[model samples]
Target: MLLHYLKSSLDDIDHLIDLTKKDIEDIKEANHELVFERTKIKNDLVKAFENKKSLLDNELIKMVSNNKGMDLESILNEEQKTLLNEMKIKLTELKSVNKQYAKFVVIVSEFYNTLLDKIFPRELEGYKKANRTPATLLKVRA
Candidate 1:
């Protein structure tokens, strides 16, 4: 019964790891969205001009153009920009957190495997040691 309870506990931990992995995936997706939003905002900041049009397709620029909101600026105000910039920074931080979460998931998975290995080392070793098993002969006297 104690062994069964321990196994159940490990299964619960595995489930927690699964849930944490999902959260990590969600953080990554949110980070991608934030990056895209930042790019779009920066592009809008510059796309209204002639020579600045080249920056739109580069996919590498980081700064919003100096052109402050004269006409198109009404679409997003200073407060909105500030909020988005803050969110972008937060998303970046979350990405770093997601990296740590990934490492934690790997450690948890490895720990479970180690525990299972300890419980069945011989069977595991046998599978690793040989691809084929030698046949055993039996002698019989009648």
Candidate 2:
């Protein structure tokens, strides 16, 4: 009976290890998606800026040809202005979401490290000892 219980415990540990591996993989995938989304959002912002600049240049050229002396800012159509504002808002949102994703990744990484330490304690201990040395106290005599 005792032997059966020990076997079951080992099996449970194995299952937990597998689950932890899957969780780590999922976190990595989420991190990649966040990076990709951020890049895409940045690219979209650049494109929007270029479009806005082009519109302003065209308006300036039109004003110069017409001899009206109009400013570029006053020439933006309502729809174009709204689109630019929407893109800016989306860019800010993407940045915020990416920051949250980074925080989640850190949490997942910490959990993964904890699991690794439990599964391979000797290696984890060695790494911890090498990286986290105790601070020495210096005695100063005046």
> Which candidate ranks first by lDDT, i.e. highest?
2
How would you encode candidate 1's per-residue C-alpha lDDT over 17-107 as one tens digit per residue?
4444555565455543544444454344333322322332231122223334443334445654454455456445545655787675576
Which 10-residue window in model 2 sums to the lowest lDDT?
Answer: 1-10
lDDT of each: 0.44, 0.51
Once fitted onto the true fold, the runs of candidate 2 whose alpha carbons sit more than 4 angstroms away are 1-72, 122-142
**Each model's total of backbone clashes:** 0, 0
Number of colliding residue pairs in model 2? 0
TM-score for all models, in order of appearance: 0.35, 0.39
Worst 10 residues of 1 by lDDT: 56-65
lDDT per residue (tens digit) for residues 14-56 in model 2? 3433433443455667655544444555455446545645555
Model number with the top TM-score: 2
lDDT of 1: 0.44
Candidate 1 wrongly placed segments (more than 4 Å): 1-74, 122-142
